[model samples]
Target: MPYLLPPPRAAQPQRLLAPTVTHLARLLLTHAPAIPPLLTAILPSSPSLLTPLLSHLLLSHSPPLPALSLFRRLLELPHFPVPESALPVLLRLLARSRRYAHHSFQLLESLPSTHPHLLSVPALSVIISTALCASAPGASFAAAVSCFESAAAVWARAGRSFGAAELNALLRVFCARGRVAEARALFHRYCDAYPPDTRTFNTLLLGFKEAGHAQALDLFYHDAVLRGFVPDAVSYCVRMDAYCKKGKFLDALQLLDEMRKRENCKPTLQVFTTLIYGAGIVRDAARARRLFDEMEQSGVTPDRGAHNALMGAYVRARDLQSGMALMSEMEQKSFGLDDVTYNTMLCEFQRAGDLEGIWKIYTKMTGSGFMPRTRTTMLLMKVFCENGRPDLGLELWDYLIGKGCVPHRHALDVLVTGLCCRDVVGEAYRCFRELVEMGMAPTERAFRVLEGFLKKKREFGKIDEIRQMMKAIQLEEHQAEEEAA
Candidate 1:
């Protein structure tokens, strides 16, 4: 009987102790002036514990009082190095409050000098994005641009290289808002400071592609390759999609082959998906089918997006049988359909005015445990109204609301307008009032439709009440815009 060696004990990885928010909150609230020494004493080995500790306080749904109090206390400790991870969340929280918004900007402007480590790309992006979303039209752009320059200046002083990521973030913001020209100008202005990298060119390429600047996109791609920045899959995708948008499907396919032959650049799923979507837009079902098959042969297993894009092509080309067959195949693969899948089918049904098909898709969608989103709600309401079934539309609205779909003002507007069109004014008024009670105001067009119906029906009382409500809503919105700015 040979003695068996005991199995070697498995090594246990060290686990981080969870920060107790309650204890920290009590300390901050009770010993406001002594946070620094107390934190140092408690977290002697890990000052970074304050990171997750502050994150919990800031991100909680509880009233902002505790978080604000903690933040003020932490800010008072000039030597405390606020974690990079916490700054973005803290800025977002402060940006949401009218009084604290200025403090957030002040902190952003001062962070690189005051705490350079906390001036992360994500933190700057959050501040820039928040400023860009401000309600006052051009003022928002001005603020965003100002913040961008200020960050650049502060970062330069902190001996930090404001690199490609920070530049790309700002570029994305401008491009996303359809400010491609401005984004290009920004690229030019910063190229000297942050030498243009592959991602820099890719960002501009996508910006130009989205803005429909075909000539600029072409020129930029050539310039990038000439400048020794080898175009990656993304670069190829942007150029391919640009060609597709210009109705040059053959050229796009040729480029796809070109990328496949390259050393490191291989055709990605996006590459295939882009071609399929382009084919869909042109109603070229044959091309889409070929691309889908080629994608699988190339070892890029099709995801939901690829399947949906193929389906879109089939339906657009009036090949309903092929579309249904493809959908069945997707189900057979066991990945199951998602919101986009259902929505794609619904869009086709709606476009064809096939109310029966729409209902079938809706049934399947719900049977799969899918909840209706705003888009789904809008489509159903529109189709129902078009089919002279405002009653069903109203019922659908109630059902969706019951299922916790927050009332979408646009969808409500569609239902109300439909009701008014079909002379179901009383029901429309009731729905409008319900929306008001739910703290949403429908579109002005819906209001006008309701008002017109009331006037014809000699319901001056309801009209007067609605007018007053509209005035109050408008005033509230104006004040909110001011605060947001």
Candidate 2:
């Protein structure tokens, strides 16, 4: 089989100069039939750079189904070079984009019949690993277990057994769902085929730390060391994080000491920052300050993240002045404050009923080219609603909607809940109706708030209307749920 030579460079000399993904996407969209040949010709030149081009197309330009269609076309071609390097990137993009993650797995099932060259232990391992992060059926523990079952079915049908890494990813998923015992059971079941590695144990430790099972951390470490897995920086970080989380500050400090004594296992910036946050969490600002100084003394420069950790500690301690001073220092060092900084300040000022303070930070956030995030908008709107400034909340809503930006469902929920609480039930009703029309469900909290208002007013007719609407919505939700399954 002859290779697919490059398309006539003479015909498109300008393409050689730019070769931008956006430009290629335009070409593919306009000349859909040419995608396979274009890919066949171009991919061989630089698979590494061009692999990301396909991802850019999927994530930035095209939807999943159509983008996969193009990929399928390339795979089906007569002389196309196999897109081995690119497939991982494509699969990862699919897994992370919540609307399209399941399609990523579906790609795995399609591989045997269509693109077996793309099917391998390594590729499927990556797909399985990425799929672990994708949501399960219902986001419950049972859903998580079921997700593993479905993944196993996909594995069996693909005619391949999982490698250590894939199995570890599956184990991580189970542990993350607060089903640590299930993860442990699954690991033991497959230990002979794929024994736990350092990365595997690291994930297990992180999962326990996240799930708030500090006690499990020690058990896991003992098991790992007994099994001869060399403890690495990741191993210590997990335990240190667990220690910090559990308010074992001195213990966390002791672990830092132990880490220092180990050859090639010095405490990282992450370790120091973790301790600082832990100190902040338990209101040990003095210890946190000492850790910062210690970090600098150890030749680890305090980064923006370190400053943010201290700011968070100050916020927790209700010391806004100190937090502001910390912010000023970060700025003087040209360390840009992130959404975390602004959101923390916004929350602190909100608690103090300092409306002007809230506005001041918000203005700075917006002026500094920071787009409003979901949490930032929700809390800001909630403050307005709570402090008898629903008008300002509505203004912000209009501003968002005018720019064709959809606020988070929770933001809309806050608005409706606030309107009903403030006795603006008619506006709340309008907002609720618009949300439903937009094909997004209002939260049960929003519905209850509105229903409470209508009941207090004895609006019997409106109550009947709400009842009917509720039934219809429930039916639609059930049907949609079935369709998704």
Candidate 3:
């Protein structure tokens, strides 16, 4: 074989120009009024050079305004033709930052009027999804609706409708956040012009089920069937879960039987797990065990989720023996224990106030090299604090740091609250300081705990300092929210 000329290196111009372009972009951002002749000189030489430079600036987590300002300056250049590809990159960059979410929305809203050719389903979907995720919930919802309506008008002008996927994405976001009412209205608004698909119905069903609106979910499920849409596995799962949620196991079982009879809709692992978890919630360990058996018999291998569900049921029923046996079976089957399994056992032990059992699980958890998550850390810290062991709580904090897991503010709240309750004010103050050193502001709850403790101890100087620090944090956060808005 002819020596495959070592996959061609990056063109020399790109390698050389990238650094200079980045420097100039930074220079322009920092030192505004960058020499226009300089940009005109370099950019005109190779218009292609600007694409990577723009992408780099946008994606480098630089403040959005300065980068957008640079883009504007480049736009004024006569020779440099900024690629349309830059639009998506810029939109993504802005969407990712809470501070620039409002700006991203502005860009999205303007696309229909300013760059209608760039208005497509996927581009709109990205903005919708990103806004829903990256901004405050109330603001995100308003922005999503605005973006969708804007895109819908543009699509209508072109004699077309928004794709089902975009509609489903918006529906999913609404449903996920317990905004089923808004989601339902949105679905109905669009369903007439663009017929709803199976996913649309399933999404609504799941949303209603999750919101604990069983009656509404049941009605919606039947309504979808009435509209000639066949219920899929997800639909059946949602319905079954709704019944299970209400502890109407008889109804849930009936639905399961109906699901088995259906030729197309087979029960998935999630379906079984839902039922098992529901059974556990009702303390029906026998039923949960039988469901686990049925799941395996149905040729669905019991994955970590299935095992965890069964374990949770046992924990709920206080059947530690069965839980332990299942744990052994899990290990034997190579379905090694995960954070959920460990957390479940820890919860059970914590409830029973069995310090020995808690220690055993904690040791095993850390030994397994799976770092405890925020919730787990918080739970353990609370337990230790309640048990008069602030020392152990601090040790857990150190372990978390050693594992490179940045403990969340909620965890700090637990540790601080626990310490204050135990009158370990000194340790609590130290813990609070450590968090501040890590550059994370403690939650207001934690701050209040320290403030009250310091006040009680007559440490007026420290209280004033802490009050000042909290005020500064709140001011910074308020400014960020305003910027985001």
Candidate 4:
């Protein structure tokens, strides 16, 4: 027939992959009914034009509306080279929705030709900050490296001409995640182009501590100031924290003194509290008290943090009398006791087999409506288990789950471990199942504990069940890792 005959060569048009503009417009109307009229006016409803009309409109539209992200996807669907002009708007949209940001980044990199203009500075800043901050939950320190690598690829491809703000944003992400070596290398390489600011230096100082290289922090700080980046109060506080983390309390105190002597560099509460924490670790309650007094003298009233630190010090020194006295003083100041206060007291009492003290503290904590954190709950679990009160420990576990408090894997492991040791297989298996349902795979220790009990009982069927459950967890985790990567 005439239709069966091949279409005339002159009338033949190329096959199109991208949905037609009419189809895309219908989608916009269906999915995004509240799309701006301005956008509607711009997007022509032409069927022949296969590329989405919204892709072109993205360049001109600057609204923060959610509809813009759909255009980013439409533009990338047919592997179209996105206009350099639209990068900023797309990035701002991407910042609000990380899923789109990730897809756009992936698509942009996949396109054969690289456009330097497409990697705008503001976009890169938002990309670096959001990517790192939205990093996978429970990601270890190594994940920080992968996150920086991803951002760095974007920077490198964009001709690496990012502005100071973008570089600072990337540096902050690096420092936040303990990638000190990477942050320092990046700083040294790019600092000359966009000279590091005081905030940049402060972030790097914190990074050294987080990276367990506090020994290098002092030298880095001295070199930074000598390079004409004057230290601010926050800078001093960061350095003080580094020294405190390194167990150099005297050095921290000396740094505090130096900061105080400097014009307009008064140590903040965090600075004093960091030193107090150091003093607590060294059992130097006297020094913690001195720092506390100095904090008040500096016109920064001691907050609950300051009280917490000193009280922690007393507990460390086994001077419960002094710690209790401080608690009384804290009450007078209307500074309510926190979980750490109760946890520290409970742990010590647990060690001493003081059941009465533990009971009193538990009663008070529950009575005051203080929602205990995972640590508080874990400490309580351990205490109850060690004191031959497995029933209470199991009840507490159930109570936390009933309260919608998803325990950490390690915390669940603690319960499993305790129960398994007591040959309480049924209860331990219940906790294991609960953790599985909560999407948390138990620790190897937890598994080993359960396996030991199951094997001793020669219950190969349950053993097989444990293996199957573990396989499911491993498969799910592997899928998640693939998705994250």
Instruction: For each candidate in the order shown, give its overall lDDT on alpha carbons.
Output: 0.74, 0.69, 0.73, 0.66
The Cα error of candidate 4 at residue 95, in Å, is 17
lDDT of 3: 0.73
Residue 129 local lDDT, model 4 = 58
- lDDT string for model 3 (362-414, tens) is 77777675666656787888887677776667777766644434467777787
lDDT of 2: 0.69
lDDT of 1: 0.74
Local error of candidate 2 at residue 251 (angstroms): 0.6
Q: Rank the candidates by TM-score, best first.
A: 1, 3, 2, 4
State how far residue 71 of model 1 sits from its true place (Å): 14
| Residue-pair clashes per candidate | 0, 0, 0, 0
Model 1: per-residue Cα lDDT over 319-416, one tens digit each: 76687688789989987887677778888877776666777776676556455656777787888776677776876766554333335777778888
Which segments of candidate 2 are over 4 A away from where they belong?
A: 1-104, 111-162, 331-335, 402-404, 417-438, 443-479
Arrange candidates by lDDT, descending. Answer: 1, 3, 2, 4
TM-score of 2: 0.67
| Predicted candidate 2 versus true structure: per-residue lDDT over 59-115, tens digit per residue | 332333445556666666666665667777667656544555667666777666555
In candidate 2, clashing pairs total 0
Q: Evaluate model 1: give its TM-score.
A: 0.70
Model 4 regions lying over 4 Å from their true place: 1-166, 172-179, 192-195, 208-216, 245-248, 328-337, 350-355, 369-371, 417-426, 443-475, 478-485
